[model samples]
Target: MKVKVVSLLLFMTGVMTFAQEDLKEREQQAAFDPAYTSYSRKKPAYVTLKDGTKIEGHIKDVDRKKGQIHRLKIIEDGKKKVEIQATDIADLYMAPSGLEQLDKQANFFNDATKWGKTDATKHLSKGYTMYTNQMVSLKNKKKPTEYLMQVVNPKYSQVIQVYSDPFAKQTASIGVGSLKLAGGIAKSYYVKKGEEIVWLTKSNLDEHFDRLFMDSEDFKSKYEGEKFKWSLLGVYILDYTEFALDAQMGEAK
Candidate 1:
């Protein structure tokens, strides 16, 4: 009886050790995975113009120069080839490739945006490509110009548009030797409402949250109650959008 009990204890210990190792491996894999993938392959696409016109086609290729989408080439109705400047696009949608789907799943698991359960991954899961062109100042550019960006909160289309910068990078220091690793994408978030676009950063999220979302009292209450962190900015935008939409619908009724 004593021998059996000892063996059972040893077995449980081994199981726990294996579980911890598995968890650690997952964490490491997630940490090294890229947050988003670039769209290059031809896929069935729908594009909305700045003037509210919609185009249906397959996106044959997207040219990126200096980490910004330089031009968009698409085949309309499988024949007419149309090349559009990045600035002319309001929204672009495409079906994800198998590899892109896997990337999205990995990003969702890692909570790349720190958006808790309410991140942009929900749209990707529902087959929303969520890409758009927005005016952003590039490091080499003298003026703010349009570039292809990912919409982090597509459901908030009416109130505000939250975008993830495709070219953004984050640097991390890790390991006993303090190795610095950089090259992470989509580390920055941008918000667009009306004619202006604002970068949502740790320094300005708190300051801008109320100013931009002053219409949603319910969201404000929740934000204050939670002592909102920068990581929760995505959730804040989503909740505020819902509340704002409700108010707008009520006013319409």
Candidate 2:
């Protein structure tokens, strides 16, 4: 019985040792950071159609070799799946930035010298330069209401996003290039519920988030009953890769 007990202990010891070694091996394999320039071009797993439809799926086939159509397959459920001809796709989004994504990957920064080169330099790493594109939902707002806004600067990415929510007053947006932030005087108006964002775009870039918009008459009307969703990519201070912007996810090949 003593011998059996000893064998059991030995087995457990071996298992634990193997587990630790496996973890160490994984860490070693994931040691070096990937180069950026190549990764930046990687797009996300989904695409936005021109008709404002967001399609999430796999690029099972793209016949660009001959035709311009990209055949995609979206799995709604295990059984309810469909394949689509993805020619009308407008935009593609990537998942998230990588390890080499940030130039100075530190939590706290002593660098406040706005747009500096070294640790004392600020303005955010890569360039604080971001790109932006936005789409607005206009089911009943206006006939020419299929609206989308885009900007080509990272300076404008940091903007105040507010809504007419009785509970949550304001939030900050780190969008790509542009946003529609409004300026001042809270309003009381008759309207249906759906407004999402409160402030205007460029205005938030100038003032402190807390002091940006205190009161605005059109605030409630613009965002009280609206749902505004925006995606803000990196100000990517580091000389990153194209794969950072586009992660080749949905592509099957």
lDDT of 1 by residue, 127-207 (tens): 556777877765424488778776655544556777665556553434211212334323466777777787766666667
| Poorest 10 consecutive residues by lDDT, candidate 2 | 232-241
Model 2: residue 75 alpha-carbon error in angstroms? 2.4
Q: lDDT of all the models against the reference?
A: 0.61, 0.30
* Residue 183, model 1, lDDT: 46
Find the candidate with the highest lDDT and give its number: 1
**Inter-residue clash pairs, candidate 1:** none
TM-score: model 1 vs. ground truth: 0.61
The TM-score leader among the candidates is: 1
lDDT of 2 by residue, 48-149 (tens): 666888755433333321111234444432345566544455543322233133333332233333222432123224332111122232222423221212
The local lDDT score (0 to 100) that residue 163 gets in candidate 1 is 68
Q: What are the candidates' C-alpha RMSDs?
A: 9.8, 22.9
